[model samples]
Target: MTQQASLVALQERVAAVNDVLNATSVLTWDSRTMMPAGGAETRGHQIATLTRIARDLLLAPETERALEEAERAVLEFAEDSAERRMVQQTRHAVEHHKRVPASLIQERAALRTVAQAAWIEARSKSDFSIFSSFLAKTVELSRAYADCIGWNGHPYDAMVSIYELGETAASLKDLFKELRAGLLPILDDARSRPQPRSDFLFRDFPEEGQRAFGLSLAERLGYDFRRGRLDTTVHPFEVSFTRNDVRITTRYNRNYLPASVFGTAHETGHGLYEQGVDQAFTRTTLATDLVGLYAVGGTSFGAHESQSRLWENHIVRSRTFWQLHFPELQMHFPDQLGDVSAEEFYRAVTRVEPGFIRVEADELTYDLHIMLRVDIECALMDGSLAVNDLPEAWNAAIKRDLDLSVPNDAYGVLQDVHWSTGYIGSFPTYTIGNVMGAQLMETLRRQKPSLDASITAGEYSVLAEELRTKVWQHGRRFMRDELLERITGRRLDPAPYLAYLRSKYAA
Candidate 1:
């Protein structure tokens, strides 16, 4: 077969795999959002069936033949060319999947929905026992999967690589250590200041109003409603079937204003990344996380989180954002925020208050939350931590790190939806994203001198377009460090991020 034809043949098989995965995503999204609680078991089975089918199709002999032919066909292409990246990533995924049994994949996929359902119940009741067995099984499957993937350092390294690719437990430890050194002083300085008046933030603002404001905020930030949407979920997330149809969900807190506002912006950042991916890459390897078996366009979990954190904290939480758009927000919650000024609101949102929830954590205390999770995750994966002991470990970490006592499992071990959904090693990516987002923003400020002015004027498209060209357009063709090096002339340095925190909070 001709080189072009051979590449096309491989792409066709990949597109099929992408379709099945996307179908699975649709079901997953439904299970999380609209599905009745009673449907969890059947939904798990449905997702597992599709997941196994996708995996089988990806590992088929026909796909191997096509991949072989495409590998030779793309040899003459540039190393960074999309054609080459497609074949390289696919081959890597196929080899990686070959190491594990198909049944394991099915088991893991099936457990996610049921576990998530159990988690929701457990969290609502402030009880960990309901979810402990499911979590133990999840940890077991994760360990087995890690062994299959073969890790030299810690089994958690294998799990981390599944999401962040190149990150390991050791590397995360170093990163967290550096971050803590920089953040601790800032946290101290910020805490020393008189706290901002945030009573208005807790006033009752109806959910309808919050959703309306969130929708407007998303639109203003260049989230295309034509290709995407915002919905309410217990936990906020962004998912895309392809570049054409991306959806984001954010949970609302009627008594806490920033919850939906920042959650929407965070998930909008994720949606923007998915929507910003080049259309040509749709249904291709560039838009699909073959290893994670998820139909996503972002290169890595960290890269994706960078976008979310960038929009949520760097932009939306900035003084300029509230200064420019606070009037509209006040219009939505006139009684609640009418007496509040823009600067006061910004300070309230940005105040360095350590919180029980990671998603609602202030920027300064956020990474500490991530570090706590990573420590527990590592201990869990290595058999040093037991499932029954999770609440104690979580509470201890909170007290040691944030000087807070855990009120309940709902506010402690059961807070995050990640572990229940089998995202074992993904917690560190939140901090990674914060670092990467700051690094990218630092570079962006240097490259585009008008970045601040544009953002101040609420012209987010200025920053959005820059990211689309530099980061989003390439989809998953480049690794996280590669993207960083190409754009920032450095690879995942924490210096810029630390500098950003220092300037914002300490200095």
Candidate 2:
């Protein structure tokens, strides 16, 4: 066949591979949010089969030849266009998929399926030992994955790449080192300040009221209920199989208000990003971040965090924000919010607190939570840390950094399910994204200084639209660094994040 015909065939083959991936994505989303316990085994096999088929298609010799033909054509035709970028991205996927043994791919898929099931049981029983072996297997799988993928910088980099796309161990180390140096002293000073009163937030907020408040907040933020539905899950997360079928989950604590409220806001931010991706890009090679994996990795995650943080901190916790919504809150939880003034409520939510669980950690100590997790992941990958002793190590890190002790395993090691899924060296992205969010917010404020006023009045679409224009619509079309530079006029600077924390906590 002519090279042109070969390239056309390859395009069809690539689309078929993407179709399988997209189908599996739908199944995975369903398995996580809606599948019954009885369906785990069947779903596991289904996902495993689809993954193997997709890998084979991706690794096919014909596909490789087509890619070579396409590469030559792209280089000769439109090397600087988005089409060339898509070709390059396809090449990257082909190379990465071919590097690993198909057996390794299938094994990891099966293991992840089992591990997730075991994790659900262990988390339910609050028994770390039940999941320890599974976690060990996960570690073994991750180690093999690293070896298969290979890394120029660190073994950890190979593992981290699946999520962050181009992030290296060496780069993160330098970034985190600078972040720690700047943050630790400030947290130390803030720890000595009188803690703000937040009795209102800790008081009983009926679950029904929390759901109503969350749904209302989502609607106000421009989330379409027809496209997305909020539900309860063991952990709060947003999963979207398609733009129109996105789903978000939040866990509610009847005694703590922000858990559900901010969780909803955070996941809603994710949903908004999914929904905002230009519909025309859907089902094409350009559907997601095609700029570069690393760029897409950093900016997309950062963008999601920005939306969540904007609604959670800049809007939900603001005094004026409280004034506009406090009456509704009072109506929902009369006994809880009746005596609380907006100033009192705002101070309460923003109070500096060092906590064991990263998700529940307040703003001042949130990055510290991330740093501890980063250290632990690095240690676990490098053979210095053992799965069995993770709990003790976890408590030690908490005590050293937060001046707190683990009251129980539930609130300690079992708190986050990230490790259960073999997500190592990924937590730092939360801190990185938080900083990026603040940077974007700072830039947004400068561009539209009245943004705070709109947020205060519970008008979020204007700000959401602003973000949709600058960040969301692109959908991984630019590398993370270039995207940040494009939008904020600077590289990834943690100074804005540190500054935001300092002003909020140390001031």
Q: What's each prediction's TM-score? A: 0.99, 0.91
Predicted structure 1, TM vs. truth: 0.99
Instruction: Give the best candidate by TM-score.
Output: 1
- 1-507, model 2: which lDDT tens digit per residue? 664665566567666775677677677667776788778777778877887887887778877887787777666656436556657777777777767888877776666656777778787787889888988888887888888888776688887676566677787888888888988888788778898887778887889999998898888788888988998877888765546666778888998898897788778877887777666545445453321111121134555666666566656656677778777877888888888887777777777786666777787777778777778777778779999999899899989987898886777777887776566656767876787788888899899989878876777888899888887776645656677798899988888878877777655
lDDT (10s digit) by residue, model 1, range 221-336: 99999998888888989999999999999998989989899999999999999999999999999999999999999999999999999999899988888888999999988888
Q: Note the Cα lDDT for every prediction shown.
A: 0.94, 0.74
Candidate 1: regions farther than 4 A off:
none
**Model 1 weakest 10-residue run by lDDT:** 498-507
User: What lDDT is reached at residue 362 by model 1?
Assistant: 90
Which window of ten consecutive residues has the lowest lDDT sum in model 2? 289-298
Error of 2 at 135 (Å): 0.5
